[model samples]
Target: MSTPFPSDETAKETPASVSKPIKSAENASLVDSSVALGFPEGGFTAWGTVLGACLIQFCGFGYTSAYGVFQDFYTQTYLTNSTPSAIAWIGSVNAFLVLSVGVVSGRMVDRGAFYPLMKIGCLLQCLFLFILSLAKPDGYYQIFLSQGVGFGIAIGLTNIPSIAIVSHHFQRCRAVAMGIVVAGSSLGAILHPVILNNLINRRLGFANGVRASATLNSGLLFIANLLMRTRIPPQLNAVSYTRILKNSSRDGAYICACVAMTAFEFGYFFEVFYLQLDSTLHGLSEGFSFYSLTILSFGSFIGRLTAGVVSAYVGIPNTVVGSLLISSAVIFAMIGLQSAVSVAVIAASYGLFSGNFIALMGPLVSYLTPENSHIGARMGIMFAISSVGSLLGAPICGAFLTSHYIWWKAAVFAGSVATGGCIALVFMQVILKMRQKASSVCSKEAGV
Candidate 1:
């Protein structure tokens, strides 16, 4: 609760009463372009940053979105000895590291270490995927090292900072810009499967196909390195990372929001991870199963924009609730989709809704924090915490499978978990609104 403006003049004149100077050396660079700093909102530099970030997202999240195909392949061919649940951990580990290591990368971004992180991320992402191409059919450990650990670290370093830099360029359209930037993943989702299917199923075999994808990635990372630039330097020592965590954790609303985010992430990738498996089980052709991911990605691309634009009218948290609620229903309905067409429809709908939900994840972290300066660190901490869910969700879902591959148990688990996340979000929303109302009343009384 807000402490009312002190009862007496002297109490009101305490350290907290002192207004922070706007143009101080520390935060002078942190000011917005539109309101004060005069940076162009939609100029070439700004749009370049967006495009650059899009490439990074496409490379990182979008490329990995195809892990389902790989998971199925490893189970069916390469690592036949390993259980589907074990194979699922490789992808889960990737998702885990991508988010969990944000603590390091996020700190670096706050301290103007963007280029260093990007260079490492770009190199590691390319190098490890190539290394992955060398692993043997039973090389479960090798796959985990290269793809799950190395690639996850690479994306962790690269992804959040990529989108954060875009915020440096656009102010009013920042949300929309972020939505478009994230939509890059969906675009990648659409393109990578076509590229992979051509290579894996049609032209080259698994080994050669991976090498080809790695080669393509080197070029994309080059562009990303070129175009992504930070608009202004952060104020050194602006806030201690520890202080931000302690302060934020003390807030009931922020804690509730984190719980909500964790729940959503827990079930987020289950759909992507199992989409192909389910399609193949339903008697769809191999090509059709692969193409289902493309359909989902296409829908996600549209969903990202839809959520961003709609949130502009309603609200971000509210949009998350509504969209997640719809997506959760689609996820449940997907359990009954015996035909390719039914699978496509559910995949598309889920993509649209889940895309918006994904786009808002970073923005919502920034929203929940008390200080804008702490966004990167707070986001890092938040993702690290939530990555626990992403890390375990798949394994848990996989364990529910039976010997017969009647995977309805996994489907039910995914949907139910997502619905639980939505419930947490609702609680968070109520708490946040109530706190804002309380603070406003306290401000009014002080003024009187």
Candidate 2:
């Protein structure tokens, strides 16, 4: 919450180019207000923004988490002729856009476009869900276009801004607050699969089930629109995308974190998309497979809540690194899961660790941000870059799985990729510590 800029004396010593971002309207306002009065941290508007963000996460990423249910359903009945790899593209693309399109939306939020983006995103999300419900049982392209592309874009527009807006209201408790917000996705993931599973497979049928969800999402998004308010005004003269990219590329810690995120995402969804299918293939009861997603999401809810509280003590980077390591181990353990109890344990464990990554991602980006104004842009770029992994990971995992459904190869591939991510995060953390140490030594030598 301190001024995002150096003192005028310090500024004189700093190069003009180095201080350029400070002049931007967004950054300037942040510098002025924070220097004069600090963040609210917790108040009605602030908590309301958090509440709104939670709903946004619930509608956006939370619902996206339930795509595995859709994946299982489509593979078994709807898209019967499609290969698993082909079917996975639907979920991959949905996840990809959910993260990728943040580049545009995040930047827009920085420029004070949150309300417009949120409104349009909410409307688009509902519209697309309705369209998705209209698709025929065998209509692969229709489903792909409606649910995959349209819904993804809608959520992408909402997700990043909902996250970025929190920085406007809270700083000290940002991690915990964002953790609660991200946990909304876990809540959605928990409930949505149950709703979709029962409605589509048990009672209402696919189209009506989707319609029911769409109707529910519409109400939730509408409430979010009303409750969430941005405290920071837009930066009319925000930095250019090229400059944001150029600056981000030069930050070793940022680059390393982004790489870690990409690698983490590459392996993150195998369990989410494949758990039910795996359970069914292993001769588990339909009832168990149907609720496996719910169990995983329930673990995620606990994990996300735990992450914020834990990160307060361990630090965000350290917590993230630890989570990545455990998640990779869980993924590796999936090689030959057969017993229902064993599979259940692994699913829950994976969900717990993986949920940490989601909860901490925004805080991590905020920690790395050079200025408050860059929060949106930096998060956008990071998510956009990492989205490539989300885009490709599932289908690649599916391809690794053969016609005979050899699960170990995909497990190896996913776990190994996640391990690579853990290493990157470890490296990033070390670099951050070294920087902090060097800065501390300089401060001491300068004698304040």
Candidate 3:
């Protein structure tokens, strides 16, 4: 409950008996106490939470981000009997789970189960990673069970909460904090591949390398659990899912953002999943192609940070609309890349613009929310809807290629979808402005 305001008795007595400076001090104390009940905004503990959330992203989605390297290794060394498409299902399922599980995990966060969920999720990830270390060579089902399904579910449990937790500690600085947190995945993407490739290819074999990585991740996750803390008191009263959905459905801005998220995700993974192969097909060296994802990820790291800072000044909606348009243009430009330099430049450019959506999405959801308490459930619905695109987008892009890869077909398809999402973001922005204007007009007419 909010703190009570000063009573009318105090106001009456202040003018007659209280000194001016004393009255000012009383008002200031009240304001400070009220603000304390809400977001801390910035403090040592709040930033510590951001740091811990970053580690969660590093250990969770970071590994998933490097799945391209894993896929390449499996296709060549261990899982040769399985068709590339069949093996691709493993990564696809993992991606789907990472976002899809938010449907339940998000609600749990709202109900004040953040720590329990984090602990369980981190444990599950370590457990599955260890189990993944034991799978025999050419054992497709074993890998699928341990790495694909088991690990995916584990990451899913923590994925939404990592982003949602930031809402508790930050209000004004939230955009930048979320960006920094999500940027952890980019750093992980860059580093994990180097670790996996060197250990698997030159030093330890697959099983031992996975075990080593799992040990390292366990330590990091332990640190994250200790560092992260929830600031908001959870609502104990149960809220109906049907009521939340019904309210969200009536929101034009929320619906548009959902559609935009789904469409943006539909095309977002095309470069991430296929860039190395596409570079190789277009005549880039195998060594360069191998590092293509790393380069893209590095660009994304910078891009996410930049987007976060810029959005604070320009506003989140403006930043998102600009990012969508630029990203769509970059995807379209990919069709013309012929030389090694061109491929590298385009990959970096695409990463720079595309990274904006990742950083701003959490803040965008919070902006659209009518109540702070609804942030978790609304974010869950958004992620679950967008997971559809993540699950299917890559497979559909792969289908566009013949036995000999025709990269342009996929490029054209992906670009067009991103453009569609861009248009929707613009529409969402317009709707938001209209609603604000209408609300302002009503307030003025009511003489408030």
**Least accurate 10 contiguous residues by lDDT in model 1:** 1-10
Where does candidate 3 stray beyond 4 Å?
A: 1-49, 136-138, 164-179, 229-233, 281-283, 312-315, 433-448
Better candidate number, 1 or 2, judged by lDDT: 2
What does candidate 1 score in Cα RMSD to the true structure? 7.1
| C-alpha lDDT values of all predictions | 0.75, 0.80, 0.75
Ranking of candidates on TM-score, top first = 1, 2, 3
lDDT (Cα, tens digit) per residue for candidate 1, span 62-89: 8888787787677778888887788889
Model 1 TM-score is 0.86
Tell me how candidate 3 scores on lDDT. Answer: 0.75
**C-alpha root-mean-square deviation, candidate 2:** 6.3
| TM-score of structure candidate 3 | 0.81
lDDT of 3 by residue, 92-128 (tens): 7788888888677866775667888999999999999
- Using alpha carbons, what is the TM-score of model 2? 0.85
Q: List the residue pairs that clash in candidate 1.
A: none
In model 3, the clashing pairs are none
lDDT of 1: 0.75
TM-scores across all candidates? 0.86, 0.85, 0.81
Per-residue alpha-carbon lDDT of candidate 2 for residues 1-448, written as tens digits (9 for 90 to 100): 0001101111112233333223443444444222223467899988999999889888888888888888888888899888888888999999998877777787677556778899999999999999999999789999999999999999888887787677676666765676667667778889888888999999999999999989999999999999997654455465666887899988989998888888888777888888888888899988889889888888877787787789999989889899999999999998978988978898899888887876788778888886765665676677778888888888999899855689999999999999999889888988999999999999999996
